[model samples]
Target: MSPTLSPSPFGTAKTLVLKVGSAVLTNADGDLDKGMLRTIADWTSERMAAGCNVILVTSGAVAAGRSALGVRDRNLTISQKQALAAVGQSRLMQIYAELFATHGFHVGQMLLTAGDMEDRRRYVNARYTLEELLRRRCIPIINENDTVTVDELKFGDNDGLAARVAVKMQADALVLLSDVDGVFSANPKTTPDARLIEVIEKVTPALIEQLCPTSQTGSLVGSGGMLSKLRAARLATSAGTHVAIANGKRPGILSNLVAGKFVGTYFPPAPTHRSQRTQWILHGRVSGTRQVVVDDGARDALLHRHKSLLPAGILRVVGTFKAGDLVDIVDSAGRLLGRGIVNYSSAEMDLIRGHRSADIAKILGAKPYDEAIHRDNLALFEEVTSAR
Candidate 1:
């Protein structure tokens, strides 16, 4: 029986980012699935003809390269995986180039690491490059730079990478093509009664608990699972980009999905905020240098008054860090207010803590900026919590 296709909210998106996992692009025997790749390319070309911009974020190089190298080891070392990625990235892009070209569409490959997106200058450069590609009528096929990525610089999975790309390009929607049809109330394979959730308005903790019990393990060929997809959904939605998680194995799935036909789980966008810096501050995985606690008055001034974080409001600085590092801003009760880039080093902040902004010169002997965290660089937690 054909699964029922309902209206999708993605019908209106002008620019879309579509991500396909390793499992979707690989066969059970672990070779690249040429048929599936062709289908996706065809659909993407058609979408482009209809005046919609499409960026394809894909994962399969490691799986494909490993197969070509005749390595059957399930657990390969980081170096081995990197070797596979180095080898397979080219082969994968070759296939994409050939297939997309067959349909009269050009493809541009972009390899990136999480660090590239975290750095402000690199982030801007990437965004401009993608925009220019789209303007030139070329589809940008992106993948993680797995060959050189280490733990600190890794996005861990393409799910998070796709979300960041969507936000960076100001895409209207993000489509995640995976092995599953959608997010089920329970594991569909183990539980016959598991219900497929059609639309998710919010990724609440309760919903996560109900759908994801233990962390979901990906298919034999992919690293991303349900948990990573959910995290991606949260990030994309928070940035006002709608997201859809659907079965990639289905024929013409991308076309059907954007045609207002229900395919997989859909996550609606949050309130639109055009501030890209704010989105970066909210979702960028730059490890914070320290925790800065503020009193209720400071919290109100930051949130309601839309003011910069002044030294007067800082209660304390918790750790050692240099200037220009990310820091967490919390309230007296330990509630997370948001995150921002601090202008002063932890040592300097310690000296200026609780002092008025005017006294910064007297204390640190030099002040780069009056605000501890400028309003432009600050982002508030999107979740609503009662004032303590």
Candidate 2:
């Protein structure tokens, strides 16, 4: 039987990150929706005055630029979209500055990409920058660097960005503000009787496949869909951050959320809590297609004994990856054990698997310490096989 979902008692989340979608940021003419922006700014200011930290992950730079250029090219190439974002980003920030200024608030613009979140050094630097902004009572407004983010331009959205940021910052709650109120049992447009799922206990592979059958496109200006939001929710919640998918169009939605009013579908954070570094390892991007499958003994050591992965327990190495890169560690059955920075490359791993630590120098003619993945660099996931 499926587990019943219930909302956790999250009393006035102190640190909040809000992801406002392109639909809410732009109007019908593919332009920036200043009125809506002002409304959001107003409530957000009120929340700030009440001593709540709010960081905005916004969308609509592309649409803003296209509207300014009067370019109605629906079939825009990746280069074209990048050009548009380059033009619109400044204009978008300018407007955000003006609106936020009226409430005696300052907004800091941060243009990020997927690559920034993958490299540990870059990720740490970005977090420090964000922390400094918040320390000065400045609202950090973040968006994808679409002008140069080739991968993101293909299909990524701020929804994914927001999730990554929330986990990195260890935010108390992440509110995804979009056109729709929340995730539904089915597509509301086609399935008239489809009910809104008010609470999601856990997001599993089966649940995602059941609801998001065909990807639903966003507004004329945006590209993200409900599927993206669900994925975002899953990522954030796994890192022990509460998530809510609420309607941006709903009047006083921000105020309602601050007041603890029921506004959207809620996803309670999972029980396990992790340190900041652990959060990064769990969510950090894998460098290559490489996966190191460990034997049963290795899996036991990682999951229960809290030991670093050893070359002796590795059954086989798959794909190619260099040392110091992030890679997935899996069991022989293809179940993910964890992910971490590898101390050995796939080429080296091939020769070292099932070998004794003392034999490393004999085989490779050198040694670079022991342990394929050190415990300090590894992070176990919330979901893992039960201990035998």
Regions of candidate 1 where Cα sits further than 4 Å from its true position: 1-12, 152-155, 271-274, 288-290, 295-297, 315-321, 385-388
Which residue pairs in model 2 clash with each other? Answer: none
Q: Among all windows of ten consecutive residues in candidate 2, which has the lowest summed lDDT?
A: 1-10
lDDT of 1 by residue, 1-388 (tens): 1233355455567999999998899888888899988888888898888888999999988987987899888887788888999899999999999999887888999999877877788889999999999999999999989898765123257899999999998889899998889898878887899988888888754566667765656566787678778888988887789888999997767767767675688888877554788888777766544788998889989878889999999999887777887778988998878888889988899899899988999998887789999988888876633242
Q: What 10-residue stretch in candidate 1 is worst by lDDT?
A: 1-10
Give one digit per residue, the lDDT tens place, for model 2 in 1-388. 1122233333366788889988888777777888998887887787778787888998888988998899987789999999999999999898889989998999999999877888888998999999999889998999999998876777666888899999888889998998887988988878899988888989865688788875665555678888889889988898889888988988877766655675578888888767777777877766457799999999988988899998999999988888888889889999887798899989999999999989999999998969989999888776673433
Q: In angstroms, how far off is 368's CA in candidate 2?
A: 1.7
CA lDDT scores, all candidates in order:
0.83, 0.83
Top candidate by TM-score: 2
The regions of model 2 sitting more than 4 angstroms off are 1-11, 214-220, 386-388
